[model samples]
Target: MKRPSLVLCCALLGIVPTACGPGSDPDPGVDRGDSSTVDLEHLAITVSGRAAVFPEAARLLEAQGQPVPSLDGVVLTVEEPLRVGVSDADSVLGQGGIGADGGFSVSEVPVRDIHLSLAASLQQEGFVRSSTIIFDTAFTRTRPHTDIIDARAWALPNAFHDALTRSIGDASIRAHSGERASTLRDAGFILGRVVDAAGAPVAGARVVLDRDDLAGRVYYPAPDFQSATQDGTSATGLFVYVHSGTAAETFSLSIEGTQAYLPRNAGATPGLGLVLTLYPGNVSP
Candidate 1:
């Protein structure tokens, strides 16, 4: 079957998928053009935590009964005026290197919210660098004197956002109370199914969920966070996308090969699931 054009999906969702193309700024809410101009007190932001491999990558390993990847040696960078998503090359505010103990600290940071980007190189000889993981939550100063930022990157299925938020919250509380914060680990899931006009399962359909605010930043399931699906849909036309966070946020859904589907676009919540139905009809090319 011919794959449905993504352009159509974008149109149906009332979103321009390419609005945030390279070199284009999609976030008008905040000005992140330059971090040097921001006049803020320089505060120490100490980050300590484990940096695990991408959830999706770890899922692949677990499926094959392979040992889970380590969280050590991950390089995390903090950026100011948080962007919609992480880029390969972005201006850095501070950086920390995760050690064998899964702890690293960056000091002398401006008192403000920051975007944290986590990246690491794989030990495999063939596959070297891993994709950078950015959380939806921004790390902000919880207290005036508190600079210690406690965090953790775990291999939890569909819980990165939740874990990060919890960690940040705990760190903020600790900073206020002048105590050390503990690590965080939480997860959430998104279940979905694609069916045809006659209510029959439509296997091999591609479904994607992305933040409405971040035009180009797409979220996927664990073990394959980069790809919505490693293989096509299941025999039952069911697919589940996981994330490490809460489901209070709204998201836009896009279905591939939707030309055969009647109502392709559906509303989605982070932890909640969605169902898309296809009808036997001729769609425009």
Candidate 2:
């Protein structure tokens, strides 16, 4: 089947465009761009616990396999700005909402001086309370995927955008805390379907995204943190494309249907022509 495209792990990082088509589809959701310079993007950040109760709550929630964003009730200040930082820019890419999933999305962001914060409003019968969390302003240095400019890259911007959005539950967890960085693991191109020597796509074959470490600093934009999918794939054997935040000097970057992940933090960027491919989908498997 001639599908559109899918970028499972697409985040907004400023860099030169390696291969951007002119007639690319317009951002489907909210438009966060101005007249100056802007690009529709997603801000994916890792929201960890800051206090004893918080982290414990997070772990408890995780154990139940509940979505982090759904923790708004347990944690206070769900409807406020708590995230702040000097992110790697890509964490705050695109604008608008694409409701392919239950969560809404938005793309088209102003390239200059980007910030993702949250605010809370209280309207209850007893002990009313309100607070807001503000994220640090992350400036865009350039467009993402510059080195791969020459690679025949194709992205399903909407799907990429959806996967990039954080649930309201995720926002609540990240709003109250300090910054905890995850090591940027070695990332590679994630194929939608397993292919044979003849490059024939394989269905139900399992094409996974893996890496070595988790050295990347997590950042959350306005809406939520990041997201995941345990659901099975379509009959076509396709999953979302994920970009590894990890970086490598001599690596095999897959140059096909995919999205780029920064193995590091929200705004960190490597040199141009950056990518690698790992066979069998494991570094030490």
Top-lDDT candidate index: 1
* TM-scores, each model vs. reference: 0.33, 0.21
Q: What is the Cα-based TM-score of model 1?
A: 0.33
Q: Which digits, one per residue and each the tens of the lDDT, describe model 2 over residues 92-143?
A: 3332221222222222322233222221222222211222111211112222
Q: What is the C-alpha lDDT profile of model 1 across 79-104, one tens digit per residue?
A: 42112122224335566676777666
* Cα deviation of 277, candidate 2, in Å: 9.4
Model 1 worst lDDT window (10 residues): 135-144
Best by TM-score: 1
The CA lDDT at 285 in model 2 is: 10
